[model samples]
Target: MITNDAMTVQDQRTSKIILAIAAITILLATFAGKMPSGMIGALGIMVITGFILNYIGDRTPIINQFFGGGAIVVIFGSAYLFHSSIFPASAEQNVTTFMKSGGFLAFYVASLVTGSIFGMDTQTLKKAALKYIPVILGSAFFACLFTGLVGMLVSKSFYDSVMLIALPIMGGGMGAGAVPLVEIMSGKTGMNAETLMSQMVPALAIGNAIAIVMAGLLNKLGQVAPNLTGNGQLIRGQKAIEEEDQSTAPLNVTTLGVGALLAVTMYFVGTLLSSVIDMHTYALMILSIALIKVSGIMPTALEQAAHSWYKFVVGNLTPALLVGIGVAYTDLNQILAALSPMYFLLVLITVLGAVFGAGLIGWMMGFYPIEAAITGGLCMANMGGTGDVAVLAASKRMELMPFAQISSRIGGAFMLILATMVVQAIA
Candidate 1:
């Protein structure tokens, strides 16, 4: 009685209905941890929850309009579940364990970082890399100036504002930015590193949350005024190059295997380079891949393979990874506890300053403003890998990851340098 198209629609609806029930069941079930079962069950639950929240976000009024859709929903919804005690402690343990011990987060990042760099054109890579450092400096400078101004107005010292709030937000994520910063400030100001970390960590959490929300708002702005963005493109003059990554490689088993190996090996190479350089492994990996990309030495077939694998991972696993981010990284309670009028104002100002600086400078350099703000700005303001994912997902610009990593790693390094200098000068 029905045509093929109608039958397909019906099938899709049925699938959605089943997924909905499964999602609810995950919420209600008492899951146990036993290696494989624990890993599979937790992953399944997260994926289902993420899809449902994403769907709900797409439907919600202000959330959908201002935040773009499910990325924000998945983030906060996961946090809400944890905060509300709807997500069981055992399930949370299982999920987090898998994310870390089982290395899902690392695995996911390796694939994307490897692919994003290799996929870019050599000329584009060379040009973007050459110009991105100055953009980062401007983003950092404005963030510090604005945050310090707010801090002084709120009865906090200019030194405290620059050291605790502005620097850490621009310092990349928690480990690279705040941890090292704690050590630096401890030596400079005679504050206990742990105590300093406790204060600084909250700023990062709050800043990351604001950055995600702002990313969505920026996307909305891009929609209202198309001139401000290259849609998903970072560079204004460059063609979209490829339309939102349509990987038609058939998910060939051999190709995927090669791609996965390539991803892991690149990560390993980064780790090795870390001993020689003081930067994070991911940052090092980025540098190595970028160098290779711009060198024009990698074979065409390999480049295509990396892009194919990137497409596969991005298409298939992005939703699941978002769910992991909700459970593993997004912590609402920490943010809530850290809020004070002065502290909150300082963090907010820092994020806004980053947005303004990066947007203006990048626009001048022939980069799209929205892309610049999100990558060059919010990427600094947010919590590194997970933050980058959340911001990009919110802005609907996942392809700009190469630039975001540059912001986090190089920008983080720059922050460390700035912190040292500020401490020296102030002391």
Candidate 2:
């Protein structure tokens, strides 16, 4: 029989071989003309770059110590490659096309949203949902106010500060956050939606970068001050221990399929509702999953199945998802163009405001400050689904992803309405 250590060594060797083969394939495809352009090529390049950047970032002494280890590296590295034209226009287009048009992000999000909701303890879901909105509000209030103050001191107006810098940063992600807000601003300001969005994209990107780095710092704070964190839980004393990963369910191909099916179904239901109400599918999906989880309509066997599926997806797909994000969404040129000293300072202040506001309010409400800030504040400030994953991973509190989703989806929706009001009041 193979000893555990021997088996572990074998797995490592297998992983190395896989990485080597992936790298070799990408190198050949980059130079050669016959590389496929759809999912196959996209997956190949992302795997190659994601693994390499992730490995290097994690091994580097200072980068790994505080700046979200590989998470920051993957995003910035990918952005640099794309900006420098090293990613080959063909490969870049191929990857971007697959991620957006082929529905890979939607599919990935469907599983995470569904499995996370269903895997939680129902009571925790029910109770936490009641007070979480306050946490979101706290994050936004501070982020906006502080950003507005900075704007006044700079050449920009308070309105410009709030809408241009603060709103986009907290809005959610690209599609769910900025796109919809652009529509509202177009109507309110009579500027073209695309034009308005162009001005705001840099803020979202930089805010997301700051949020990811802060997540790592917040994790360190929690470690130094154990009293400030409930590990991954938001609320204290009400089943705060994370239950999503505590599945005793049998792991098999069949059960994983069942889990995937359940997640897809929930996403479909959310999409169906979106036809009637103008909201992001993710928000609707969260509500639907929470309702079912709280109502006890789902069976124990099925819950466990979902948990196992969530575990599997988060473990295997996260790195690839980050790669896709870097390839499809991150734009180093856009970020660099917006990176004047004043611009960076404004965005940094917005993110800091979010952390402090959320952390202070969370502490008042008996929630751990570190957990609250990471989930409520950084999650809002980040780029939406992709940003949430990166920030939470940096904090090493991925079990808090359900809360992070709530902050992103629900909080993002709230930002749209607030943006409309801000436009009406100031514009």
Best by TM-score: 1
- Stretches of candidate 1 off by over 4 Å are 1-3, 6-38, 240-253
Task: Give the range of the ten consecutive residues with the poorest summed lDDT in model 1.
Answer: 28-37
Candidate 2, residues 1-427, lDDT tens digits: the string is 9999999999999998987887887868775755688888787777778778888888988778777788778877887786578767887788788888988778887887777777777767777787788889999999999999999998889988998889989999888888888988888888888788888899998888889899988887887788888777777774434543354677999889999999889889999999998877888888888888888878978877777788788777776777778878887777779899999999999999999989988877778889889989999999998888889777877668778888998899899989988778866
Give candidate 2's root-mean-square deviation (CA, Å): 2.6
Taken over the whole model, the C-alpha lDDT of each candidate is: 0.84, 0.83
Question: What TM value does model 1 have?
Answer: 0.92
Candidate 1: Cα lDDT at 171:
94
Could you tell me the lDDT of residue 76 within candidate 2? 78
lDDT (C-alpha) at residue 22 in model 2: 71
